[model samples]
Target: MLDGIPPLLTALASGADASIPDLAREVPEEEWPRLLEIVRRHGLTPLLGEAVLPHGDTCPPTVQDALRTHRDYAMLWHRIQMNDLALILEALGGASIPHLLMKGTALGFMVYRHPWLRLVGDTDLLVPADRVEEAHELALGLGFKVTEEWADAHHLPALQRESNPPIELHHQSLYVPTPEPGYTLVPVDFSLLDAEAGTVDAGGFEARVPSARDALLQLSCNFGSHMEESIARPLRWVRDYAELLGRGRVRWSEVEERIDFIAPDLRTTVLMSLALARPFIGDSYEPALLEAIDGLPNPYARLTRVVSPRDMVHEWTTSPRRAWHVLSCLMGPWRATKWSLNKLLVSREHITRQTGLSGDALCMRVYPIAFALHAIYHLRRADRSRGE
Candidate 1:
């Protein structure tokens, strides 16, 4: 099943432009049946063929099978979102955290026709930075253990819950690395919280969400930071921005002012989002959106292309290199080196705590091989540069 279906599903997931014939040619003939079953289960077959398959006179049998089995997976993804949101709000209320729902769920409840139509995996909640520790305690009290214990042990405040439907607690608006030295597009300023809580009924569950302006800023900063697949969680932010614009919830000028003041570097991401969702958002924002695009730096301006191929792969994979990259991005070069060394030391300490190994013994057993590999890679690169 994996041999046949994994590659095909991967292609579809990555928005690849392979045709039915093209896919059939690549897939192993013996595994085609199992591959088709997996594709049907995911409900991606029809969307893949109709939206992605190239025009051709000859179509593969798998194409027809996939089309027949295709259901809207987006809707299913949405139902999961609704269930998760319900759980998140319940957890927050139980914990006594005065939370504001941030991105996808908030947008869906406020603007979209059906909340399930917008695909979201987890629910995001915002609390004051000062209240972050309180929020974590609240989540723990409600049975949601932080998923990344290593991160928590390292002093990163973000925590994930162990609930069937997980909730992520954010005290800081943007993710900052301990080793990385850089300012975010959105500075960690809890002063921006001017809370105006209102309730929305989702299938009889009441949800309390953030104010319109703050919600927009949170979503904008999140999208800006992770520009690669901002579009993956679709329609929520578009609906929010459009509805806010339509209702005069906040003036266009005020939105622009907040964008400049809070997440100035996100101008590129916001404009790109407006452009992608223009079909849903409409033409009125085109001029201002283009102007925002023009204001972005050249690197950011080309963000769409910059986050291609390997970028998407890295995001989905759990390779150590990706972990290292995340560490590097959070902490700049010098700090990353120091952090890695400290992490190695701490890891040894933890190992010693669990086992009876002394610190020097653990370091001798572990550090030499790792350090040797680093030395070999650097020396080889230097030799290549000198025509070795």
Candidate 2:
């Protein structure tokens, strides 16, 4: 309820440490409307409710009614998702294909109280890379409408069903952990999917969820990517981390080692997650993780954990030194060179996808024009910034 804090920030890091009475006392009754709206926007109804429900009878029924309403709505979606998941799993079982559930859906049944309170929007299931085509076929057989685009670099394009959340069948994870002689990015081994992860007891059937350690990575990766957007991702994601951490299963040291292997550029999302969760600047986070965050080549990159990339860009417009630091941290000479090479060579397929043009001749012709326009747009934006 602090006025000075950015409107985009629903809950500050310190709020995690504050009790419901403290929150209620700090946010006066006149401000409850705004506070409630913030909590609602951040998907924190159940989380906040759980913290303060002991005083339910003392408080107004409207607040209780709101919590119950949100929980009821979430529960309905949870049942629907479970049913849909069962149907998909049954089909996959018949086809002898095993899969791992990812993100909110996985965390719903496994990490949280139930899938209902967690509020999943869609089902994200990771199938083995070899089985992606087969899974795509199975989805088609099950009458799912495929939302295909050209050359999906990561996961297979989403497939949809009527009146149900869309299913995204993934072959590649959001952060591709490719460890090799010439390593670009590396994290955990896929073997951990089966070996470390356990099956969730979903009444009659079971669903697979990542080990607690791995869940941290997934949660962090998802959080890092979405932190800049003033969307519900960070709100729900923060609670997810809280829930997972509360379970008391994750080993921070092991998690740190794996994060170190991936490098901060790849693990930046998780690092940002830790900053929000533990507030590395504060006391909640461990020293090792903080060390890992500090180990990133550029120290200024840490500012991104608190403020968004867009907000930082605004700051860059006013300050040359900060701008230079950000540019240098994100783009070294070697990375810049590799990026140019990729744009000239590997970007052709990506360009084709962007343009929705299939033929090589047409795509190649359109790409240079697209690149030129993109460059011009950036240059104009820079010039405007200089003027500002």
What are the models' TM-scores? 0.51, 0.69
lDDT tens per residue, model 2, 87-189: 8888888888888888877887776655665656567887777787898888888888875352345467777677566678876554621111112333333
The numbered model that scores best in lDDT is 2
Error of 2 at 348 (Å): 11
lDDT of 1 by residue, 1-388 (tens): 2222255455444333344456656666567666655443332344444543444422456554444334244455455546655666676677666666666667667754555433354566766666667766755665556654443221333344333334566665543222322223244455455345577887678876666765666666554433312122232344455665544565545656766776665555455545433443344454665566556554444543333333333231223343344334434434434334343314546656765765456545544443334334433422322100
Task: Give the alpha-carbon lDDT of every model.
Answer: 0.48, 0.56
Give the least accurate 10-residue stretch of model 2, judged by summed lDDT.
176-185
After superposition, which runs of candidate 1 have C-alpha atoms over 4 Å from their true positions?
1-96, 150-163, 174-191, 196-198, 211-213, 228-254, 261-284, 302-388
Error of 1 at 350 (Å): 12
Q: Could you tell me the TM-score of candidate 2? A: 0.69
